[model samples]
Target: MALNLFSRKQAEAPPAIEAATLRSDRFRLERQSDWQRLESIVTALEKNRPGRIADDDLLELPVLYRKAASSLAVARETSLDAATLAYLESLVRRAWFQVYGPRTGFLRWLRSFFGGGWSAAVRDLWLDICIALAVMVAGTLVGWLLVAGDNEWYYRLVPDSMAGGRHPGASPEMLAQSLEGTEGAEGLTVFAASLFSNNSGVCILAFALGFAFGIPTLLLLVHNMAMLGAMLWLFHQGGLGFDFAAWLSVHGTTELFAILLAGAAGLHIGRSMAFPGELSIMDAAAASGRRAAVVMVGCVLMLVIAGLLEGYARQLVQTSEARLTIGLVMLAFWLAYFLLMPRRAMGAKVDPA
Candidate 1:
């Protein structure tokens, strides 16, 4: 009789523990259908297949999420099974990401960036742009004066490889020929590649060197302008100044503007770091960097367009008037796009809804 009583007591102890487990199982069973349905709807939405879910179910998502949240709180208090709790938590997390995360697709982002972001960034940093232009002008004046005073300065300011046999000593006929694309098809290809590569390198260097507080970027801009001045002076001495000007105007307008924008971008970062104003240095730099990057992206595209003009139009368009017209048109287009376009209002919020 004692042994039977002991056995009965042990069995009864299990029933007490099992009763709590039974309640938990019953609770889950009652809610499992709803949970599974919510999970399916969320999964479809997450997979970007919202069409698979009915409109009524879509409307019910918020309600379902709220119920699950309440159930989670109750489950925690009641000491629900770990598996059930984990599944609920995971479901809630996935649903939250679908509801609140960034929904902008690539095409939308691209449109926004090109439509307004680039021009707005440029406008915001207008001060830096002005500074860059000033530096370039100063450099150009210095270079022109130096070469005019001494013909030897031409050799020093312009690289022999870049001048490509056209220098201060070249005769008027030679200089005119140089402007008229005397190079053959293969040579023109090589020249185009070299010009694009060199210009692109300058733009990249200007932007990259901004971290040095902008000094290097300024120097680079000045150097580039000096080269332009030297070349112009050389052609002037040979009596090809007018023709060269027209030829350069075709591509120089776009190319030089791109470089200027790049220099502005670099200087933006440098100035922000040097004078952070109210913000901390890190915060200022971060803000300025984002704005500058947008400008630089547009600048690179401008350079590509300039390269095409230089390579094809400069070679094919024989008349100086035609070249000048093309250059002026491109310059006007860029000016209107960047300067005249209406900008987004400051502190305007991007609607993610």
Candidate 2:
């Protein structure tokens, strides 16, 4: 009885091993042609040596990848031999990249962004921009009126550190000197860094606080511009309003514009969530977030430009005319670029740009 049991066990093991070997061989033979073709195409693509792959092979890449992926799944379920499973996996990975991976390099993506992608995105948010602009204007007026109604309001609106010696009822001489870029080279460098940090913080915060229907973003914008209004009223009272305006404009043109875009971007996300329309809230938010993110990237670049203008150019050029010229030129350039660049790239008329 023991001898019979041993013979039966040995016989069963041989049959099982033969079945597995046969399955692996059959699987390979059935898909071997596709696997080879996919491997060739993937190799050519990886080399980035264009014109090496035939047009037909390029078109068939996706199909071949899907087939290989399917085979991998089957091989695992059937417990195919290790070598065959490994080959399928390797082939599938290489083929998958050629079929679906990103083909655009960094340069290509950068060109696309600055060329028209950014401006087009901005155009889409024009409505939000208008709304944000209106709210900012209103906030500025509120600050000005508050301070005008009571001088004490200026202190409340403007921090002592920022106000320095320039405050309500400050003599015109001191206020004028303040605008003359009296800060030395080292001081200007430090001031520029500080301005960039502060401005960037406000812009990012405005953009990041869009989830609660954008109320916080709106409030933040109002509060931020209120400080500007207070300072403006103070300068005007000392009869240095025009000088202060020119000073602020030099960098404020770019800095304020960046803040405007940030507020708009935040509003867009909140608006999408508030009114998802045909899509679910999550879907609407996801789509709007993508669009808003593009706008925010451009805003960051604008803020950096603003920082350089404020920190260096504004401090170096003491003349009001020169400051105004620089500010207006920057403003005009931004308006034209955002309004015209995309149309020009698309071969459209440049009217109103």
Q: Give TM per candidate.
A: 0.72, 0.81
Clashing pairs in 1: none
Off by over 4 Å in 2: 1-16, 23-40, 49-79, 343-353
lDDT of 1 at 123: 93
Model 2 superposed RMSD (Cα): 8.3
Tell me the whole-model lDDT of each prediction, alpha carbons only: 0.82, 0.84
Candidate 1: residue 55 Cα off by (Å)? 20
**Residue 211's C-alpha lDDT in candidate 2?**
74
Q: Give the per-residue lDDT of model 2 (tens digit) for 1-353.
A: 22234334434555658776676667777878887788888888899865998999988887888898898999899888767777778777777666666566778767877899889888999988998999999889989999999989988889988998998777898888778875467777778888999999999999999877889999999998888999988998988788888999999999999999999999999999999999999888888888898899999999989998989999988899889999999999999999888531222211111
Task: Report the number of the highest-lDDT candidate.
Answer: 2
Residue 61 Cα positional deviation in candidate 2, in Å, after optimal superposition? 4.4
